[model samples]
Target chain A: MFSGAQVSLYPMTDDFVGVILKAITALEPYRPDFRIETDDVSTLLVGPPDQLFPAMRDLFVTAAGSGVHCVLAATVSRGCPGEPDDPICTPINDVHYGQPLEERIAAAIQQVEAAPKTGQIVAAQFSLYPLGSGHHMDEIYGCIEFLKNSGVFDRSKNFCTKLRGDAGAVFATLSEAFLRFGAPQGHVALDLKVSANSPTAV
Target chain B: MFSGAQVSLYPMTDDFVGVILKAITALEPYRPDFRIETDDVSTLLVGPPDQLFPAMRDLFVTAAGSGVHCVLAATVSRGCPGEPDDPICTPINDVHYGQPLEERIAAAIQQVEAAPKTGQIVAAQFSLYPLGSGHHMDEIYGCIEFLKNSGVFDRSKNFCTKLRGDAGAVFATLSEAFLRFGAPQGHVALDLKVSANSPTAV
Candidate 1:
């Protein structure tokens, strides 16, 4: 079963996708069985882990050559994003790889909680590109709604409460989320901070 | 005399550029005098900083709301990337930002001589990206040529005989070279490393 992979390319511009596409194709020699489907700026590849890992390695090496920088979100298990009706038979969730606003927030919170410090707020911030490509406001609203209803966080809290727990638990949750939304070669920056409430130079 | 303000928006896909344009135009109320241009995935806005700041602020706010995460790079300079015919009113060689890369390196070495730890190279790495549009191999050879001619790094006898500077410095140099080549938004992300040899993180 295939999971999700999220990738990011720096100097993100029009021709970056071409470079990413080229990198994916180059990986075919390494992971011949995986299917690669690209739509606009995002791409999805589904296959067994053994094949997928090599494919990803080839992608990184080739992208680096093209001045591309990428981050793989995680390996997924079920669902993949493709054409709406022609959904690819992959194990990654389409919603997570695309405009994964809600899942990202949840993952951020989970990551922070997993590694809480004396005066640190474990937090993650994410950016998305949903202005075009038929992304509707309703779908975004639904994601927000689902997040609110997921009961993962208490909405009634005065401020977003900091969840305290083991890093393993937090990581597991984040890993699960990554499985759903990670893409092959898109730009996503994940900063794990143990910043104090008041600023102090590191 | 408007100190030109430059705004570069990078979208993951060309299709997303249209919506980004709409968001930028929506900021017309905030920056009425803003002049905008699009050549590929980058949208360059040149105008007065007073008006440009708010326009940029508005555009980022809307983009965030729309789920498009962006990494913004800006500068307020005396000249704009206005037109091809316009002679650069600002002197090209002024070290307005900082000493030339070579000068900076020399100063660092001298300072390190006084205090050995100052020049102690902590880390060093180098990377390149194509200039302008980045669809094809850019003549980054010019940057390589600059580094070679500048006598910046002592190829021998130095504890850290390598390029280790801030990511910003590296990019700025590369960007300047591309501009000299008459390529707008044709740039690449430089993979760099920092050392105690330099002042900032590479």
Candidate 2:
């Protein structure tokens, strides 16, 4: 079982570079338990459930607190039959492999900070897989019901719901959903993504 | 902003009661900030993102570390046009609301501990909503790609993927996906769920 996620953030302000840097930097504290990698498209976090969730929560919360509209997109996966039994998939209780997570993340963020600022807003897409549990569709429906009852889901749209206003609130909602659906009975995996923004000026 | 998540854990072992009790008790330290509520169905933690996420992380890690197969289902949401500005939704920086989370969680866990043990595995369903962003379909695609590449997505199924094996690995993957997609740009929401089981005799 290999667990990992790729995350992309789009900050809707001139200081977008700063916001992204701050978000990535926040994960530095969790370096002891996580292995983080960043490329041009997204940043990847690999580690145990305990460390990974808390680190991600902290990262997103820090980024959202910048008081600017932004969107964070990610895709998480585990229990793939196809995954290779390499060092990267080693259990958390074992010795770590590869470069230190904090240094890698810091270097990546620095590069982003130094890059020329882009005034344009970013829009990206994401998905999750292996949402199987023999009754995946049912579980998906149940998850939808749970979200609807939570009061954060707007039913006005066709496939996606609108999460408006505060960034903290949005992150909270997303965190809950991911934790619940991660390891379902009968071995289920999921695919999901979002495009978020502050309310546009009316 | 107020951030919160409602989690329900179903352990597929005879010691289900103990597992749930231990997980809830794990959050006692964060009583200062969270408002925790538990019924027969789920435990809801509402507060600042900082407190809520850390608390949930601790709880799940403790439960998963027990080495029993369990399914933890949750739904998270925030900032919807339909949500009432009740005390539960109050910002973390504001005055307190309701009873203390620690006391409530303790009482609930105690009740579970006292209940007669049911030696049956639990199967449940959950859903999340407000996954509305005009381009939700695209985000879904992105999430799928990320999961596929993560090496844990079980593509054996037609519509969903299967995440099996260690609870920690499954949790790590799900947590990453939820945190990322929960708040995408253009105001998107999500829906998902899971079911898990301990390793059966070969």
Candidate 3:
């Protein structure tokens, strides 16, 4: 299966140019592992789904370490037909879809528990879109149930579900939600926002 | 009807605290018109649906004018049962939601065309969810049709539709999309991101 994301970082400072440039270097360690491109709107990162959030966490941690507030907005997707299938954009795991929903939930939880800890506590929110699914809501509800036990699950917000924890688990939880739920071959989209070192974070 | 949004601004600089404080002052002019609260996570702006975007634009423009890259993340919603009805959060316009879908589309376009121009250009993307709408994808597709002709439509992005234009028209288009589509009384949610003054802008 194919996986990738379109991400943009906004830094609130006069030296934003400097900040953004410096932050992306955090992704350098992951280079050649993914095809990355930066455009006027957002940067495109295509590669293994497992590395998507870890790469993002490294980048944001660098930005946040500047002792400034930074926000990352991203749309993570897997199995979207609109995107061209590139051999480089392949999943690292054996993803056998059509497994029973309960099994997927158990596997997803195990994955979250085993995620590497980034040690950077962050708060994130996301809304899942399971397009073309015959029973999208069922898929959504199932995901929600899995999130409640995902260790990082925060609370139910007005529109999106919230998650807070070490950057590693938070992102791992998100990756699982995006990849494991919804139709196996249908398009699934995740609207994701992550924040680090915010003054308002409780 | 209850209409409001949860918004947060992140400034990437050592002076993020100062920058955020300075920017929120812009919303001072809109005060008393809405019930606003700021917390560790975000600020809640509850008021007439029409003023939601303008208020955000004012706050964002102020932050962007500092000659830095700033990004705003917001989730706007109307008529969610989870929220309590507040007279303070009233609709400025006579929203007859049950009107024909075509009529709603026309009115939405007219609203965008008549929007007050903020003179600042910004790019925004949002995904609308008509939670209980039996035909949610149909509603999404219909919203897409309206957006193509919205004058501010930028492109069909992977997960969400993109809009770029004067802050006024761009936000107006977003407001219309959030309010006009989906089930009239059913729960509807929008996940939104807006950015300005980015060095990466083409």
Candidate 4:
């Protein structure tokens, strides 16, 4: 089965460019575990759910820790027979695939040091495709149950949830649910978007 | 504050038209209290959250009772100073609004008597905007906590949660959160869409 996700992050701050750079830097440690690609619209991560979900949790936690509203939009998929089997999709065997985490962070900071700053709420939307699972509905149900138990879901506005305060707890809850849903047995796929520090409805 | 939501419903069965009509008819009783309009793409409901949330709950619960996969996408909003003060946004004072529930259902069924039939999974997406609240973030956070306690949220895929099996419970959880967010104190607004009986990821 092919499993992967595309994610976009928006930090609600005057220094949104810097904040976004910081978030990308936060994921430097896990770059070796997954194929990470960044474009103007989003960052795409291709890997097994085990690596992808945790990396996502870390990224969100780090971004949210800045005390600015941030919205993350992502679409996750598994069991995609149509997806290509490219180098990016292939698993990495290297135990050490990149530079040290500190070095990566330093490089990222240096790269964005000259960027302009603006304070704006980040609004994003995503869709996930968990295709070809006979028990797709069941997996969705299970995943929802997990989120309800995680204490981060905002039920008032459809599937959009809010994560605030105590970043450690928020990350733990989010990662746990992601890992469980990515389990082989569930055969789940997900799509999502979150807006943090948004001044208006996203 | 002007509060409203836009919803789209998809039923995973071939009898989608009938199912949708049935759901709409279910809300006839509250028509006077809410300004409800239906176009090709979606149905819009505007009113106080107190009345609007419960009405939506009943409609979704009735639709989900068919044992077919359904997805609802909605965007909810409150405190929109820019929204026009149209009749739809106006609160109704009528003691008697529309026909009795049975008559409305019968009418809806008759209108869709020629629809076809099939079974599939429903997929949908939605966004909610609870604007102009000093505690907007806090209210969102509170609503998320409420959903986490309610046991219907799926934490694995950001805010995307699933609703399956036991239509009653699903509706209850959904309505409760909507109502809480729509509470007068929170000054919230909402928008949404729903799909039932769809077969693919939405």
lDDT per residue as tens, model 1, A28-122? 67444556554222234555422333344445445545533222222122321111222233433233334456655565445434532222121
Candidate 3 Cα misplacement greater than 4 A, ranges? A1-3, A29-35, A47-50, A79-90, A97-102, A131-141, B1-3, B28-35, B46-48, B79-90, B99-102, B130-138
lDDT of 2 by residue, A1-202 (tens): 5555655554545455678788888888877666676643346676653244456556666765675655554555454433433345344433222333343333333332333322222221212222323333443444455445443454422223333323333344444344344233122233333333334321
Prediction 3: B-chain TM-score: 0.92
Writing each residue's lDDT as its tens digit, candidate 3 over A22-137 gives 99999998898898877666788989876788888888888877766677888787776546777876766677766778988999999999989777788888878776544777
Q: Compute the TM-score of each model's chain A versus the native chain A and list the values.
A: 0.33, 0.62, 0.93, 0.61
lDDT of 1 at B11: 38
Relative to the unseen true structure, what is the C-alpha lDDT of residue B136 in candidate 2, on a scale of 0 to 100?
A: 38
TM-score of candidate 1 against the unseen true structure:
0.26
Candidate with best lDDT = 3
In model 1, which regions exceed 4 Å deviation? Answer: A1-120, A123-202, B1-182, B186-193, B197-202
lDDT at residue A114 of model 4 (Cα atoms): 30
Worst 10 residues of 3 chain B by lDDT: B127-136
Ranked candidates (TM-score, high to low): 3, 4, 2, 1
TM-scores computed on chain B for all candidates? 0.34, 0.58, 0.92, 0.61
Lowest lDDT sum, 10 consecutive residues, model 3 chain A, at A129-138
Q: Which window of ten consecutive residues has the lowest lDDT sum in model 1 chain A?
A: A189-198
Model with the higher lDDT, candidate 2 or 4: 4
Give, for candidate 4 chain B, the lowest lDDT window spanning 10 residues.
B115-124
Best by TM-score: 3
Each model's iRMS: 19.4, 20.6, 3.4, 19.0
Candidate 4 i-RMS:
19.0
